[model samples]
Target: MDKIHLTFSQKIIVNVFRQVRIIKGNLVHQKYFFILKHEMQLSEFKYMIHDLGPYSYDLSGDVEYLLQNDILQKYDGQISVGNNILDKVDDIDLEEDEIEKKIAHISSFIQQLFDRTLVSEKNIELAGSILILLWDQEIYVKSEIWEKIKKWKPGFFSLIEFDSVWDILYHKKLISKEVYIPNNYIERLKCLNSGSKNAREYYRLIEKFFRYIFKNELNNFVLKEYWCDGNKKIDFSAENVAKKGIFKKMSKYSSSPINTIPILCKNQDRELFGSDLVESYELLNYEFSNIAFLTIRSFEHDQWILDEMTRFYRENDKKSIKKILFLLQDIDLIDMVEFRLRGIEPSGILKEKLRSVITNRNVVPCS
Candidate 1:
């Protein structure tokens, strides 16, 4: 007879059942086996599954196959080890000790996969810190976790960042998914032992890991803004404007310029501007010589809109005297200021000038 070929899912289900039976030393409830199978599907094999709105798995089908093949026996709403499985267990290669060791090796590999999916270096640092804190404390209360993080590094993280790190750790099995302690306490303890080390050394090792992984373009890499749309009008709403200004350096180095309008308010009549607008104006003033403001309101109005024109002069100023002389005629300080103020009140000519200057200076070579 040909040897039975088990699919990946079938193998996982069989292993889950085998482990349960070995640990329990007797028959196991069908519900308990199903629960373990479902958990493995969601956590270890989630990426392999297809979505049908809700996640689906073939645990039941695999179980039926196992029963038909005499690998498992069903009786009185419970599952038990069958003669075939017992004989297989007695096989030297499939002994209980060997199966456990294989399971542990596979689990470690799955954990590495989970760690690779972390979104950013900032997240990795925070996750590592929280893991260490949990190791030292050994408490899993939600409130206690937050308190510990704050006490360790005040204002270093926001609530959203904390929640994100916690979620990642839970999914990776470094922390228990259950909200309270004593739930998966044994597993949590094991995580602490595995991850616990000298704090500074751990951080140093993580930095080296990232450096190795991103070594390809570490010297000449430029930040790219993939989310930016060239044709989309720049949102001057308070939040959008503030974000743009805060990340202005990132936008400046991008391969393309972000399209922008002067200012937009939720209520057109209110004419409100956020502090970010003022900060952007100050930073632009510090960077450009010809860009001067007569008043704070003028800065808020639209004086900084001519930054593209000023940036061109700043770049040319560093070149030869001949180049400076040739660019002098093109650098219109008075006209640029006038155009900026006019743009605030909505003029077609000023808008055209703004668009032309912005497009021409959209991307400048890094110095």
Candidate 2:
């Protein structure tokens, strides 16, 4: 069997605090308390390994330790626990009862912390639910940032706490009970951790979260329509003709000239530079009357392309050559926004945007 390789992000997580484990036959000895006791210099630990790189592993046993330490607890009976029979020096068969018992205990601990955890909706949308849960909870206090929140919600701490909550909820073994804590607790908890200034950062995080979701949705929308799947282009087209020159001359005889719409879709974290829109311009320049630029941010068309487009529009007044640009901010396509000019221009709200742009066009420009 081939060994599965973790991504660059996974390696950093495995080494975050390393580990101290001793397994004896069926007995497992993951002495988490001992590790924390030896490495409890939280501030030093964070500073020493400040940059954890990209991917991080979920320190499962760490949460177990947190629950055992009583810092957090779960809702009643959400998870089950079992007797610590393996802790003794008895040689025993692996029975279902024993397995369930161990899982119950572990699950109970995990669920308790899961219930008590606080996550920001923003971090959940950005870093993803996984990172949010895997983030070490001690960072807030260890960095002296905890004192910064003047006002807070009941359960969650500062902004970062929301990230932790997101991770936990993301992969919780028991998803049914992973309840979302209301904003009230989030707001109150913000004040308690870091004071007024810290609270503001938390507030901003929440705001950014809404923005991110909206942007993410919009990006997804444009991608769904324009992104290429396999070798087939998103809006693939080809024309058949008897003789190229004769067809061109005879086709010029149509009462209504055929217009193609070239669409280019770019989904990137960085800005969409002017060069990214070149291909779209070329495809639609002559055969098409309009080009649509789709991206999460502004579509910066090259100067030459811009100049050509301006000239084309200036010359083709009757044909109405135009460029339509769709830029989504920190919002997802699920939300509604003004986009009437670019065809039917349905924001994130409906599939109508797809119908409007593709229905009457001779060409479709896609990423």
Candidate 3:
């Protein structure tokens, strides 16, 4: 069996099989396994894994999250399906037609799951949740598997010739239903009663809000205005998902609009804030276009930092690039782009000086 490097979606299936094999391979668990086996013997399964969830759920009361995501595969463990169905094969000495008949019987069971469960909209939502859970794993579902589930219904098979493919998946422990408790009235009530007034929290929330705006609202900006524009000066817009690495995987339901400027979302406090003017100058000087400085803290770039940034630009002779800082609360825009440059590694010192220039009250009365 080949080892499968599962995506988040595939992990659900792989983990189910891995867990079952672990249980089956355990000598101490044999008694419980037989109890499960005996029950499975009576079921009309075309393959074996359909019974594992109920067996484990009956014992543990908690469903495994991995099984629910379709992330598992045979390579996770050495497991097989059809032993129960095939046990009588030798006794019957099956002819070719007889073998085909048995195969069809098994295939039908597998077909039911694909047709009934996976392709349903409910399961797609489940898939989305799984992706969210696996967010840290950096697994993304592309359009191919997305469309596959969209077309599934109960009793539908991807291919008629394949016997027991779907059931085998279940029996071999590659996929299992993950039971989730839906939000109740209490959760709804709790959601309604929530509000945070902290200054830093407010800044973070505001920054988060723009992320949604840039993703959803800005997509059309690129398509209609930027793409068709005669200048073609806009190589790419701020809202492009591919360019905005983190936003690529955000939930489509999020209220972010794709903006014409690059947006970064940082969730941190205000007093511990870093210099934006400095960072922006470094980024822009490095020719990192379409950048947006977004943070959950107050946008207070210091005076030395701003001065250093402006001086650096003048020194480099690329003064055309503009600097504008927007305060999320009042939409206050400030341009503090003048000060002397002083630092070690030109970039690092440049950042420090730019912030100092922007935020410093004295300004050093530069001539």
Candidate 4:
């Protein structure tokens, strides 16, 4: 007979099957292995067999290979040692202790293989850090977390597939869902009571007030929320008003300047904005060309709240400072008192600083 050549992954799968057989004393459902694979972390697996090699292999692929080769049989959605391996299993002569030792040796070898297959240490660190955050929050929604993670480590994460990390963490049981209620009735009531009678109308009033106060300093300003292609909405946006014939006159010199600014606001019921807001910015940056400035504003009294939130994020998350600082720069703070006193005048100095920040970071402005 030709010698059966088992890959490192295949060998690990075979050992898992043997252990399951000893424990269950019957055929195991394929879903059992699937769930096991999803919830088992590489580190835990290493500890399981006293070996560090499991991380080097793709355990999922091994399961499929076993099923395909009939080394492990699947019937009625269940799996068991196949006829090909039944005789070998029956022929085993080793004592229980000896069998366990052999299994541990195999596991260590597999870990070695896994270590060889790893990406850079930095990539692993970032991936692990993000996973830990997701785990802590019990967040499983891929797109939701991916948007935030990308903002923090855009260059590194852009190259990774979110699903892959999700699968590994899921299999290891490192991340699981908990019942989450974003807002309770009391919280909702508070938001409703404190909220403006009509958010849209209130925004319109603010816009009118700013335009009236800064009539001399500002040419034109429109404030409204915009919904982009993905049905994603920008909380607040402002655009510069151009004098009649200004664009026509400037057409000869240059294209119309991108003057649209997206503002991230912190107010009651604003908790939903985190990931969704980031997603909107990403989409707008990629799809629109007229975005020139990004504004993050809150009431002056809420500065303490922002500071506390910043501290919480910095303590709980890795590289959060760089990400937050980049998004909400020192200049982006529009003190409610200051805005109320002076109105929204176009600040040439601030605009120049914003331009430099955007240019140096290679951030494509959004519409």
TM-score of each: 0.29, 0.26, 0.22, 0.26
Q: Report the number of the highest-lDDT candidate.
A: 4
Q: Rate the local accuracy (lDDT) of all candidates.
A: 0.38, 0.31, 0.30, 0.39
Kindly indicate the candidate among 2 and 3 with the higher TM-score.
2
Model 3 lDDT per residue over 134-177, tens place: 22222222222223333533333233211133333335343232
In the range 156-258, model 1's lDDT, one tens digit per residue, is 7898887776776677676764332222232232232212233233233222322222232122211111122342211121111213221233235434332
Tell me how far the alpha carbon of residue 287 in candidate 2 is from the true structure, in angstroms, after superposition.
Answer: 7.7
Model 4: residues >4 Å from true position, as ranges?
Answer: 1-5, 20-70, 83-86, 89-173, 176-367
Report the error of model 3 at residue 37, Å: 67
| Candidate 4 per-residue C-alpha lDDT over 1-367 given as tens digits, one digit per residue, 9 for 90 to 100 | 4545675446546766565542121212222232244344322222111011112134445656666767887665656567757443333223356545655554443333224432334433444544444543444334455666666556655534554555444444444422111111112222332243444533443344334333443344544466657543334544545443322222223343434434443223333344544553453455332333233322343343344334422342332111222233222322221333333333434444433443442222232
Candidate 3 or 1, higher lDDT = 1
The CA-based lDDT of model 1 is what? 0.38
Compare candidates 2 and 4 on TM-score and give the better one. 2
